[model samples]
Target: MASCTNWAAHKLVHAWLLAALLVTLLTLSPSLSAPACGVLATVEHPVEAGRPLRLLVVGDWGRKGRYNQSRVAQQMGKVAEAMNNIDFVVSTGDNFLDDGLASVDDRAFHESFVDVYTAESLRKQWYLVLGNHDYRGDVLAQIDPALRSIDSRFFCMRSFVVKAGTVDFFFVDTTPFQLKYWTDPGEDHYDWREVAPREAYIEHLLETRRYNYLDTLGIRLNSGSATELTWKVAVGHHTMRSVSAHGDTQELLQLLLPVLKDNGVDLYINGHDHCLEHISSRDSPIQYLTSGAGSKAWRGIFQPNEDKLEFFYDGQGFMSLEVDAGLAHAVFYDIDGQALHNRSLSKSNRQHVDQAPSLVSQE
Candidate 1:
């Protein structure tokens, strides 16, 4: 019986090794520079004394080929191995490059996502949102609903409120305002309506308003008693304020920042511009973090008036946050989890602040 068990273990090892080799081969291929891997990160940290909820947050990922997207996946695997409590992943949009999810079961999403975050825990749940790219690609609803059917944990267009000790999480989708194909209107070949609903420039501005900032905060505050543990976090993909090519998410910020200040949401996490940044908004004391360096890194634009900007780097890497009562911490690293930069948020500071995270190229 022992020998039979040993044989099974050996087969499993061989299968994993084969998978690794396949990934490496894809990475080495010149044509498939990006190949296929999960651009979303996988991490584990016990936020409280209860169930550990490790979250993988990313944006502007899914380039299938081109850049170091595969390296990001390899590094995230290391993070998964280090923690036992991680159960799910979340993203801010731009799930695929250019735009759209392939057909519902198209192997691309899984190949790029599922296989990349191949960790047992990461496969558990994946909550997604729209990015301008998704709108350009096609109706993401088709794939989103199907993924949920396969696993109820894919909380697309849904809210996730889970507690890990003292911390409360508000996982949100921030893809509505992402302008589809605006990055390059010339390359678009399909009807604009195919992806996101067609909205005139002005109407789009009003319709694609950022999430009602105060409303979400109010929901959170109301969801949990004022006496509930203090660490409250809000996350999405677009930047509330930044100097990157994406510019500042002004409208969204106007609605959200004031509320974040009023409610004291601990941290603002996003990944629209692909870089590593921990910016403190002069507008408020909130800490804004950008960890979208999964597949590629974008060059950052530093501004002189950017008050309270703590740290910013256009490097290739990922981030892991360790929160357990009392303190909430963040560590940014290369694909391997090596410490690049670090910071912690006071219980009061984390509740709310205005300011944010990303740049697209590392050049």
Candidate 2:
């Protein structure tokens, strides 16, 4: 039985296939992997000071509303405008509410993302990570197109090293491993409470290897970026240490921090705690930030021995990070452009030695 729609689809598909075959036959050559679009804008400290590489980091903001998401976007755009430009944007996760908007294709993407992020300069550099909400919602297809359309180079659950002048950033996908949830056969979302009717487990399937941050991406982490590079940062969608109703994320921290510390990662940016807190690790200068204020204006509650916190704020805003070699500066602002928090990190051992002989001294 050949249905009219099926016949029509078949003819269309056949025509496309014929064209592909013809092209292939005419061009008998090997194919190459898609070129890796360099992750967000990367550069080193020695870059021209006249033009600083600017970036805004925000997360958990897919829900479109007034108190937070809307206000935050407005303020972020204002800052980007003042600077005359922006390099890229990083999202820690929770791109949407409840269940990641049914799918990445949901109308919410336009309202929450497209409308809010109308800054033309920002379109090219948006790095996104899947939050728990995205996982719960069946948005695999929708998510891909939205992100790709936004920034084809935008990555999810993958690692891409970006060189900001002289620093390297290794971004990871921590949400998938945090916990696996399943939805019923026809459900668009997984119930946080009830497990899916059918549950199956696949062991050692690569991405599931939580510690792979040190294994697969290990090379990137241990690249001796030490002194050659001014700074190295690790970004994810979950928190390492936070004090809020959402509380501390011990499971993720325990598994991830050691790798970061050992790899000379100076800063950790994440979104999930729904607040902002820049904490200094007692054992290390590595900075931990919580900027889950995309839609959630949740407050922060300092933890025990939390004095290392240089700045903490609960506002609807995003963080603008500037890194120059070993020195990095961060400012979190409110909807009115008022600075809510500011923090900076400089390498105590700041020196530039020519590791590559093929270099010329600017001086």
Clashes of each: 21, 11
**Whole-model lDDT per candidate:** 0.54, 0.58
lDDT of each residue in 1-363, candidate 2, tens digit only: 444345334323222111212222222212211211111222222344556566788888887654567778877777776655667788888876767666555777677777777766566457676676765666353334345554353444333455555556666656544553342224445423211122111132233442223443555555454465557778877877776546556656666677787777788888877777777788776788877877767464545444366666665677778766555667777667676666555665532222221111111
Best by lDDT: 2
Error of 1 at 174 (Å): 2.7
Predicted candidate 2, C-alpha RMSD: 11.2
Angstrom error at residue 207, model 2:
15
User: Candidate 2, which segments miss by more than 4 Å at Cα?
Assistant: 1-50, 142-147, 150-159, 179-213, 224-227, 299-307, 350-363
The alpha-carbon deviation from the true structure for residue 4 of candidate 2, after best TM-score superposition, in angstroms, is 46
Local lDDT at 81 for model 2: 68
What RMSD does each model have against the real structure? 15.1, 11.2
lDDT of 1: 0.54
Lowest summed lDDT window (length 10), candidate 1? 35-44
